[model samples]
Target: MERNAPVSRFGTVEVEDLPDDLRERLAPVVERSGFTPNIFRALGRRPAELRAFLDYHDALMTSDEGLSRAERELVVVATSGANGCPYCVVAHGAILRLRTKEPHLADLVATNPHGCELEPRQRAIVDLALRLALHPAGFGEADLRAARDAGLTDDEIWDVGSITAFFAASNRLAHLFGLRPNDEFFTMGR
Candidate 1:
């Protein structure tokens, strides 16, 4: 590892030293971001798990599902914030700002979704996502009804819950591994 390379508390695996599959996966992310995110590098410690993780991430975040990219990122920011995941909050918040073209929206949603002045549909989505993240056991049919009443389709409702569930795992992973958000995330979209 380079002396200055960002290292997670669990340690990082060098990209070049990673398996061929992992190196291939990291290439595009590095090309797009101009640097390998610490999550990629750190999670690379387990190539197989990273592959599975990234595959699931791509399916959930990139696929043309009921949620738009911005909406998915909104779910991430909201849920991750409720989970107290600094890394996801900052990183996905940057993505949210970029997608929405609202610089302060990220911080507002992460810190206080109610204060974000979200549209009614968006508020329903955020509220449901947060409830799932903060208290999954408490999630109920009424929550789905509220989301549907706000114009979310059943597919969209599934997405809201799925994205929230995924990020709940991601948030805990960040906490467990002590993952840090890239510095670039702090200023991107602003």
Candidate 2:
């Protein structure tokens, strides 16, 4: 391991030293983002788990989902913020900014969705996401009804909850692994 590389509590795997399959998976992300996100490098230590993580991530966050790409990223940022995972908040916040094309929106959403200038739909999405993230047992049918009232289709509501639940696990893993946000993420959309 390089002395200069960032190390989580469990120690990180350098991208270059990663298995061919893992490096191949990371190539497009590095190509598009101009750097390997630390999540990939750090958690890439366990290639199997990392592959599984990336697979599920790709499945959920696509534009083809009921949520727009920006909306998906918005759910990630808000849920990460509420869950106190700075890694996801910073990384996905950058994505949210890029997708939404609003440089400051991510910051506001990460800090406090209620304090941000969210449209009604956006508010409803994040509100439901946060509720699920912070208090899943309380996420009753009333919440579902509220989501429907706010114009979220069944698919959109499903996506919001799924995204939030996924990020909840992601956030906990970040904490477990002592993951940190890469420096590249801070200024990505700004």
Error of 2 at 180 (Å): 1.5
lDDT of 2 by residue, 1-190 (tens): 2335454778878788899998888899899888888888777878989999999999999759598999999999999999888889989998988888899888898887777889999999989998898889888999999999999999999899889989999999988877878888888889
Estimate the TM-score for candidate 1.
0.94
lDDT per residue, candidate 1, 1-190, as tens digits? 2235345788888788899978987899888878778888888888888998899898899968698989999999999989889889988998899999999877988998766798887898899898888788988998888888889999998898888988889889888887878888889999
lDDT of 1 at 116: 74
Clashing pairs in 2: none
- Runs in model 1 lying further than 4 Å from the true structure: 1-6
Q: What is the alpha-carbon lDDT of model 2 when measured against the actual structure?
A: 0.87
133: Cα error in model 2, Å: 0.8
Clash pairs detected, candidate 1: none
